[model samples]
Target chain A: MKVIEPHIHMIARTTHDYERMARMHTVACCEPAFWAGYDRTSARAFHDYFTHISQFEPKRAAQYHIQHYCWICINPKEANDLSLSREVISFIPEFLAAPTALGIGEIGLNLNTKNEMTIFEEQVELAVKYDQLIWIHTPHLKDKLKGTKMMLDYLKGHGKIKPERICFDHCEEHTIKMIRDAGFWAAMTIYPVTKNSPARVVDAIEIYGIDHMLVDASGDWGPSDPGTLHDAIFEMRKRGHKEPVIETVFYNNPCYFLGQCEKFRLTPDRPREEAWA
Target chain B: MNSFNKQAALTPPKNASELLDIYFLDIRSALLESAAALDRIERAAGGKDILDDPRIQDLKRACNIIMDGKNNRSEQILLLLSHPLE
Candidate 1:
């Protein structure tokens, strides 16, 4: 099945990983700027990182026949350093002009600290000002529920933001309902080790009808495998889900969400008989 | 950088060994990045609490394995590179 990986850190991945993903039928992937497994010291570092992902990574992915897209932001993990965060935020708009750039993303609370909240709001404002799509990264494990609620409350109170234009990623069982109920998009990120597994992701799909929901592998520096996404697809198929349903979750859902930015090229496939004509 | 251009297609690897080479190269690079991140974190934190963290230990162990370059697959790659079949 054709897939669009809605959240992955391609900067941390290799070209062979792109090849493997292409072999798995990943037609497109989105890389959201995230913590480099550690904090970056300067805005220049972020600038170079952004350039690599926005310019270089797409070319790399293209070599493997995969269309690469990315999001830019001072990720929440580093947002605590307000000075550096502001410095990095200042130049993000310049990168936003890059063609492959999707929006300001993976931008939300890490420790749920006040500084993280401040930068998150500022980046949200930046997204609003530019009329860009948003991709949020909720905190992990224990902080997730509270952080997701905090983000929801902030977005609700913001008054200008549209629910459909934003996606709260890394959602779990405890957090998915609230995110979906509020009319915003929700994404579940499966991993090789910790966090949600393929079966759990399919379970979420069964529990919550696929409306504005998406699933991704969140391949990164940690113990994540991009193949886990296909494993989830296989699990869904094994559980008797129809091809169309699988296609919708894997392909069409991403198209529907990322299509909001006009730069996304792929269209959802029509039924077979219509295509043959 | 402002303009997006299509990249030229790359030929896929012909054999399983070539594919394994590509995969190992990526794994090594990723491990190096992880090692560098750990180093930065340790340095920033003055090597106090950072080294003690279990997560940091796990990353360090992964990095050591890849960097040693003496394992079965990596060693084979090294041998092939150092003594090419002419």
Candidate 2:
């Protein structure tokens, strides 16, 4: 069972996460570009972080025999600090050219504030300008509903972007259908407290169907289970979702999504190193 | 600087938040510039009295889009990117 975690930030994660994830047949993983625990106040700092996540991690994952790809974008949460954000933005090109680099990701509103709104729009514009796919991160506050609507409206109005080319992440009960109906790729983060749990994700598939949908435990910072993709897949099967559907969300859907990014490749023809294990 | 460039930096800034204070700050300038365009239009075209009018509304609409990021992931990243509570 080859599973693809379309979103995960392994830099803030521990080595144990890789061990656990590698054991589960995680064929490929996408880490949305985000702030690590460390604070970076300069372009030089961003250069280092980019290399760590976009370069070092992929090599590290190769050791574990898992394909690692990462997204490039500032998260919605950090929009207020206008200074460093610009420097970070300047460094994105260095990573985008990397073979393991995907697209601008995990970009969306968080608190739904003025800063968040500004950065999200610019990032969407960047993705469009680069002809890159997006992986968005919705809010965690009550404003999530507001953020979700704001994100969808902004994307549709951009005139250069297609919803199919962007993914809305951390979708909730109130906003999931609207995300799908708007014609964008829809995703849910399976963390313990925020977003959907595996059980809830299973229910989401029951309603939203498997097309253009992907799920993962995009946990970074708070208490989270990096193995949530495995949990969701196994639990969905236990919950009576057809085995094939479970496989589709866990494997096929993500492969299809990453395929949109020329940087990511999940070939079904060859046997992966893990397949031998 | 320009609306297109303001739109340009979002992807890279968010991808490398902790180290990119300059990126967000730069975006802030672009956003405020758009906001200035709206402010100017609001003034030249009359106050909020006629604000609902469509012509000035176009600039304001573009301003609103960039302002929206003040509430997004990059904003939250600032929280993480900021000085620790300690």
Candidate 3:
């Protein structure tokens, strides 16, 4: 089946990885702007990073025949610096106009700190002002539940925020039900270590059922692999999940969500279901 | 197949069987490493009653969770090993 890797860092991946994704039938992948494994020193550094992902990375992925899309934002990890964060946010509109750009995202809290929340709210305002889609990064491990709840409350209370147009990534068992119940998309990221394994992801599918659910291999700088997405497909197969159910999780679900943006061109095979049946 | 209708799409480079064949050695190596680590821990303990150690107990619990017939062993073990929400 044609798979859409809903969240990955293509800028952190190599052409060989792109080749593997193409061979595995990954037609499109979205890269939300994230930390570069180090603290970037200035807004100019973020300019270069966004430029590379929006312009240079798409050409690179085209060599392997995969569509590379991205979201532009001041990621949560570096949002602690107020001056630097505002400066970065000022130029986000220009990048958002890029054909590869999806929306302002991966832009939630890293530490659930006051500064991170402020910047996240500002970015949310920016997204709503422009009528753009949102992709969020909930904090890892111990901080995840609180951080997720924090964002959910803010978005739910916001007058203009539409839950269907937004997604929260790095979701685990404890936080997914709240996200889905609130009408937002919940994405389970498969990592080599320290995140949901392939078996766990499939088990979540079996429990949750796939409506607005998405699965991605967060192929980033840490100990992660792009093949984990395919491993999830295999996990579902081993458990006797039919091909349509597997297709719905890896392919159609992402299309239904990402295709909300005009820049994303992949189409879902089935009609969009507003609520999980 | 319910709502899906893509019957002529491109297949993955490696099907499920091919993937299992390719990764069998990797899985075996991981199991071996876990076994070796447990053996080293037991040897270092020198037959002391380490069963009461919380870490050992958790590991034992994790093993049982994995052996159970139910799916979601990973989630069960993760929640088991995780510190309670503070």
Enumerate the candidates' DockQ scores in order.
0.02, 0.01, 0.10
Tens digit of per-residue lDDT, candidate 1, span A1-277? 7899998898888778998999999999999998987788789999999999999999999998899999999999999999999999999999999999999998999888899999999999999999999999998765776787889999988889888899999887767777877778899999764468887787677767666779999998888989999999987766556777788889988988899998999887863223211
Question: Backbone clashes per model, in order?
Answer: 0, 66, 0
lDDT per model, in order?
0.81, 0.70, 0.85
Better of 2 and 3 by DockQ: 3
Q: Candidate 2 chain A — worst ten consecutive residues by lDDT sum?
A: A268-277
lDDT per residue (tens digit) for residues A184-217 in model 3: 8899999866678997787677677777789998
TM-score of each: 0.75, 0.72, 0.83
Across A1-277, the per-residue lDDT of candidate 2 in tens digits comes to 7888888888877777787888999878888887666555666766777788888889877877889998887766667777667666766766788888888877787677787788777777777777888888887745677777777887777777777678888876567767777777778888885567776676566655666677888868778877878888776655444555566668877766678777677853322222111
* Poorly placed runs, candidate 1 (over 4 Å): A270-277, B1-86
TM-score of 2: 0.72
Q: Candidate 1: how close is chain B to the reference, as a TM-score?
A: 0.43
Writing each residue's lDDT as its tens digit, candidate 3 over B19-85 gives: 6886689778977998898778777746466656788888888889878827566667766765465
Q: What is the lDDT of residue B66 in candidate 3?
A: 78
